[model samples]
Structure formats: C-alpha cells, structure tokens
Target chain A: MSGQTVANLMRGHIEALAARGERTDGRGANEFRDVSIETGLIGTAEGSARVTLGETTVMCGVKLLAGTPYPDSPGRGSMTTTAELACLASEQFEPGPPREPAIELARVVDRGIRESQMIDFEGLCIEHGEKVWVVFIDMHILDYGGNLFDCCTLAAASALAHAKIPNVQHGIADKDVDLPISCWPISCTFAKLGETIVLDPNHDEEMVMSARLTVAHDENGNLRAMQKGYNGAFTVDEIKTAVKTARTADKVLRKALKEATK
Target chain B: MAGGNSDIKFIKKGKRLDGRKPDELRKVRIEVGVLNRADGSCYLEWGNNKVYAGVFGPIECHPRHKQQQDRAIVQARYTMAPFSVNDRKRPGYDRRSSEISYIISQALERVVMVEQFPRAAIRVDMQVVEAHAGTRCAALTAASVALADAGIPMRDIIPSCAAGKVSDTVVLDLNKEEDNYGQADLPLAIVPSTGEVVLLQLDGHLTPDEFEQAFDMAYKGCMDIYEIQRAALADRYGGSA
Candidate 1:
C-alpha cells in the first residue's frame, strides 16, 4: 500500500492542510461531516443500525439471548462488545486475531456503553439471580477512512435502542411478554491534530493525527464515559475545551440517534 | 433448532405481525457515496434489516501470489455484527456466512467484466448490521448499488431476493416467522436485465411444483428490487433519459 506514496510530496501535502487549520476534505474545526442514520433494516438481529460519518461507515447490531448473567453481576444482565475489521475496509486489516488496534477500538466503544447504563440490565432479568438476558453489541467497521470512534458508538447505541426483545415462555402465562426498551447512550469523538481541534476527522486526518478523544453521554446529556486514543498527554485547558465540546455535541448526537432509530 | 412447538404468530388478518400486507415489501432506503475511501460504497435499509457494503480495488492484489495474468478476482465477505443475531453470535466466520460469501462472489463474477483488469481484484465487502430473515438478499443487493456507486462497469446491477413457503403458501418475501416455519426456503441472486438466477439456495422440503413457484416469486422480487436499484444508481450516475 505504501509503494504509491508519491515518495516526496506527502509531507508537503499534509503541511498545507495543517497550515490552513482545515482538513484535507475541507471541514472546519469543530465541524462534523454530514451524517445519516437508519434503523430496523436488519431483521435477523434483535436490533440494528447503520451510521455514516462522511466516508467512515460503521454498522452496529444488538443480539439478545437467555443465559446466566456473569457471576459477578448475578442480579444484573451481561453485555459484550466486539469489533470486526473486514478486508473490505482496507488492505491494512487482514482476516485474523483482529489485530491489537481493533481490540482497543472495541474496548473504547464498550467503555462508553457500559459506563452509560444504557441497557437497563435490571429490566432484562427473567428471574432474580437465576436467569437473565445478555445484551451483545457488535461493531463492524465496513469502511476505513477516519474517525470511526464516534460513528461506531452511535451505531451501537442506535442498534440497542432499535432492538426488541422477543417474548419467550416456558408454557407459563406470567413468563412470556413483549418488552420494548427505552433510553439510550450516544458518543461524540474529537481529534486533536497540529494544534487544531476537529470533530469527525476524515481518513487523512486520522492517518496523521497525534491523539483522538471520544466521550459518551446519555439522553439526559450527562457525561457517561471518556476514552483517549493514540497516547498523548492533555493540557488542563484542552481537557476543559474537549469536555465542553463533548457536552454540547451530546445534545445534537442524541437527537440523531433517536431519528435514526425512529 | 427450536422446532414447531414454540408459539409465534407471524401473520393475522391478511397482515404480518409487523402490520404489512402479504404482497407488500418492507420499506427500502439506500444511500451512495458513503465511505469515501472505498472505490464504491452504499448503505441500505430494508425493513428491520440493515446492510453496509463497500467495494474496493480492481487495483492490486496483495500476497502478490494471488494476482493472475488473465482476469481480475472477485472476493466477497458477508458477516453479521455479533449483535446482529438474537443469540449474540461469537465474533468470527461461520459456515452459513461463508457459504453466502462464496455464492455472492460467484454471482458477481458473471456480471463484472473482470477480464478488463488482468492481475487485479475487486472486493465486495458486506456487513449486516441487523438481521431480519433476508440479510443475504439485502446485502447482495446493497453490494450491487455499491459497485455501481464506485463507477464499476457491470452488465447490470444485480438484484437479489428470497421466496419461501409457509403452511403450503408460497410467499413473495418471507418475514421472520414465514422463514422459520417455511416448509421450504429459497434465496436467490438475479440480474434484473436478464432475469437470470445466478445464485440459488434451498433448504427444508419443496416439491418440484413448489420450487417453480418459489423461483417465479423470487424472480418477481428481483424485478421489484431492481426499480430501487436502478433509481439509486441513476441518482449517482446521472440521468440517462
């Protein structure tokens, strides 16, 4: 993939983008690319949604099953998060072990959801400490460009919100019923590159960025969790700015999630 | 498999559980030019089933050994996000998905003019975000829009669909219940221009009479889906008329 690097002008091209305080794709700092979301398109899954952030496309599906909750959380239901890097995304991602990068991506996505209390695990309990429903969120990055964190988070949350648990029974009247879930958690990710803070960086900015920050918030617009990627220390002022930005972004994102699922 | 014992009422009053009529199809929406890095990409929603497809390459084949001298290779992968299934499928490849991937690749091979790009490969990547009953059909259909969105040349964008029988009733498109209880299930890939079945699969029991009915129903489905496919492609490709 690197052989076509243009050999020399690479640095100069990126320098132009940095100097102008703009992305190679013409996005302004703090501006996100146009986003569209849709839900209930996948009938096979319990719930599913697809989020497109510019060219960074990610799809999320939520599956439900009756199983014993983890021992540590016997009273509450269980949740799991995983990511798949399809060969269709990029040549860089091969079909195996998912690579360490993908694992980190999945964990960051998981932290945002778990911290948000989005699933309402108590509601999933079929029996107290006996049987319960486990929620599974799978994130698949079908295309690679830039800024997957925000896109993936939104997809997962929307999928969860769009999901409907089936009514099951053991031939007992009281045990079987339809359950419609309420509430949701959504995330906003910001990238800091070359002293410019950008929202929804494209594939190019992601390729040569210093650090990226992702923050998840709930329907109430309260911060649920945060994860910083690419290893860089943050200044007090930068952290404050990021928090403020994330808070404001949370409101807008929640609406998007709702619209996507609706 | 949980058999005929479980109680699930799929249809009532000539309407499905979801409130759709028997002949009516789910609402399908599509968007192209998604995933800017890919050669072509599209996202589609058909009722509760969502599919994201990305078409890359006809550029280069890695491992260098996979490259050929005569024509391009068409490779496809169909995967469900772990959350896409009710049981939370373990994240990895599976037999059913692999089978779909292979069939989809072969279906595409016929439409794509691969000989134009020797020693190259075009990849069709499909991800199912939500699984209703007809994900393979939706994903394959979305992949066609994606390939066209990328400006790739094809005989015609492929139209895919499924038809099944429930309680001796042949249906146009099987919802979750019809699929599960269907005496026979047939999923197919069709090229709308030719009305040909490039990929076909069947399970359960179907007499020769039922098979023909399912095939005809599936063919009609392809034509129905083809209208949406053509409109989407034309929107991006510019109006010919």
Candidate 2:
C-alpha cells in the first residue's frame, strides 16, 4: 500500500478505538504516558533539564547573558526561546530554518512562561536600562515520540527552576543566586481522536488526531496560556473539560518537576 | 582559541585539573540504538560532554545532481545545541558548523561501503547536547557507532580522540580548560583495523618532536576508545562482550 493509504487505514483504526475511550497503547482517554525529568544534566549551561514524556524526549537549557536591555523593557529582563526540531529526532523533521511547527512550539512554550510571570524580571536587572540578564531558553528535541509541547514546557520550567545567575562569572556578586523563579507553569496537551479527547498523544496518535489543544496552568490552578492546533475544532464542552483536566495534570507534572530538581 | 593564558597553573604535581594522568582519557560511556526513530543511533558521554548520533538511509539521494552514479554518499551534520556551550549559540548553520559537517561527511564516506547502494545517500546526524571539549572527536566516534548500529557495512569503525600540549606537556583527551589555555591541540580519527588516519586537525603550536608525541598519545587514546565502541555495538546486537 502507499504511505498515505497506510496512514489512512491507521487513522481509521485509531479513531475507531478512541471512540470507545481506548488508546492503541492501552491508555485511558484521560491518561498520560510516563513522564520523567532529570535536571542539571548539562554542566556547560547555567541550568539544564531533560524531560521524557513517554518516548518523546526534550532537553532544555537556560543560559544567562548580561546585555543592554530593550528600550521598551529597560527595567525588566528579557527572554528568547527557540526550539530545534533536528532531523535526528525524527526523519519527518527536515533540516533548515525553524519551520512552522518549530516556530509555533517555541512561541507557545514562551507564552506559557511569560504569561505566567514565572521569572522575576526585575531580579535580572543589573542596572536600570543599562544592563540586564537575558535568559535564553533553547529546547532540543532528542526523541520525537509526540507531545512535544508538554515535554518542552516541562524541560524549560525545570531548567529555569534549576538555573543560577552567574554572579561570580559576571563579576556582579561574590556568589551566584537562583534564577528567581516565581511560579511553575505546567502545560497539558490533549488530542481529539474521533469524539474522545485523549491526554498526551504519542507520535502514532498525533499522526491520526484531528485536533490538538495545549493548556498551561500555574500552581493556583489559574489558566496561564493555551493554544489550539490543527484544522480541527473542539466543542465548547470539550474546551471546558480540557481546562479541568489540565488542573490535575499540572499538579502531577509540577510535583514531578519539584522532585527532579530537589 | 587554543593558546596564551599564562597565569593559572594547568598542571600541578604532574596532574591535570581534573586529576587525570598525562595519557589518561576522561571517563567515557557509549550506548547504541538509543533513539527510536532513526535506523541506528548512539549516545555518548565523555567526561561531561554528551552527544547523540543517528544514522538514516541508504535511501535515494535528494536533489538528483548530487548523486554519485557509482556509490552512495555520506551526508553528516554536526550541530551543537544552543545551550551546549557556556554561552548560547545561535541555532542553524554557521560557517564553522558547515566546515565540520563537510569534514565529517568526507571521513565517513571513506569507511561506509557506499558502492553497495549506488546513487543513494546515508545521512548521519550528530548532535552535541552538552559539550565540554573535544566534541568533534566525540561526535565522530558516536557517528561511527551509529552507522554500525544501522547495519551499514564498513571496512572498520573509526575511533577518534584528541591530544594536546598543556603546560608544555603532551596530554591525551584535552578537557575544556586544556583546550582553551593549552599551547596546542591535535584531534585525530583513524580506521582502527588499518591504522589509517582519516581525520586530523591541529591548532596552536607544536614542535616536530612534540607533534609526534602528541600523535602517538592520540593514537593510543583512539585504540582505547575503539574497544569501547566495539563493546557498545556488541552490547546492542546481543553479541558476546
């Protein structure tokens, strides 16, 4: 059979199974795959974490540089987020510029952290308008099982939580300080397969899912950011259900992040 | 930037900063077939440096004009994660990375049995997730294992390592400080079975005698790494240790 034909057959099979609240991997409609986070793995970077959600693995590193602040945000620090979907992670990801998916991924993750006010921007200021710490969050997709959004978010949050300001290295102080994390925003992603919404879609499910939604929430259960993806639409009730599910997922994921860093 | 820091003592009591002897290599661990999506993959950790290499294809070559009528071509890409270094590196292709990729592709082409898959291309992706020093050597070594894991036939696995002059002494497997402040650095990769050196690059300064000594040290380091590479492949294929 042709590649598309095989994909169509698989998609039909997956949707059929999903309609019964079942996943091909035997997961429930609201179940997540195993999530593991390891922090401080990269000694070269100020802070780093590797997060694996099921088989999809992403490594995030936080590097801080002292530079002139943007004119608009002279008193506040800045952040630049970028994601590399290298072909090494999967054959589907081609080499070249940051294509649509990668750009979207980075921006979505950045929105979660920024909107949540996770970092204390004022703490990063060295001198008002003159110099401030710029945090660089670089996410590397090492293995592409699926659910890159949640994996990248978890890795970035964990790495930032684990980061330390390079005070001594920058001659700003005698010792380094923590990156001044004010909150932990964990993201939960769901895929719409047939009429059922499943949490944490794997690569195979991702290939077949009609729509995807990622919702991020902070510790207080307040929604911080969200992104709806693909050409499929979600019902009003489905969006509400996703938000509720995100609350529970945030608790579990945030606990994992805390344990890994501690 | 491989020379000219005079203040700090790189050698103390004949021991390097990390306490390795002159010829001792940093601790290394290699695992094959680590990534699921690729045909073959390898993850390597040398000291604190971490790298992943994956091999795909003996498939059709793209952009028809690049095809070799007689044999497959090796397309190797070497990339460092932005956070792989102390300072963040801009993502995407830079001149340095392009050069490294070209050199690595040429080196792999020499070993891969390309004639078997005419007009095809073998893609090798080497990612330095975390780097200390000697990443090029680490990347080359990991790529060789990844190719083998892909079940690609080759004359031999290439073993790569570096030797350098720090504190006026030839040392094997230079670390970050050594590479930055040392007098010379010589990275070498060879086809272990034939001892044919396929890759060699140098920076800084070394006299003829020091150069020969560094080369010998690097060759020995490669031999040691070769054993580890063989063990990794065997471990993956369930062969005898």
Cα lDDT, model 2, residue B178: 89
User: Which digits, one per residue and each the tens of the lDDT, describe model 2 over residues B64-148?
Assistant: 8999999999989999999888777888888888888999999898899999999998889999988898999999999999999
Task: State how far residue B89 of model 2 sits from its true place (Å).
Answer: 1.6
TM-score of 1: 0.78
RMSD of each: 4.9, 1.9
In candidate 2, which residue ranges exceed 4 Å CA deviation? A1-6, B6-9
Q: Candidate 1's residue-wise lDDT over B159-209, tens digit each? A: 888887665656667776677665667888887777677989887677899
List where candidate 1 sits over 4 angstroms from the true fold: A1-11, A16-20, A25-54, A86-97, A116-126, A142-145, A154-200, A213-228, A231-262, B1-35, B45-48, B169-171, B191-197, B220-224
Clashing pairs in 2: none
lDDT tens per residue, model 2, A209-232: 889999999899999999999999
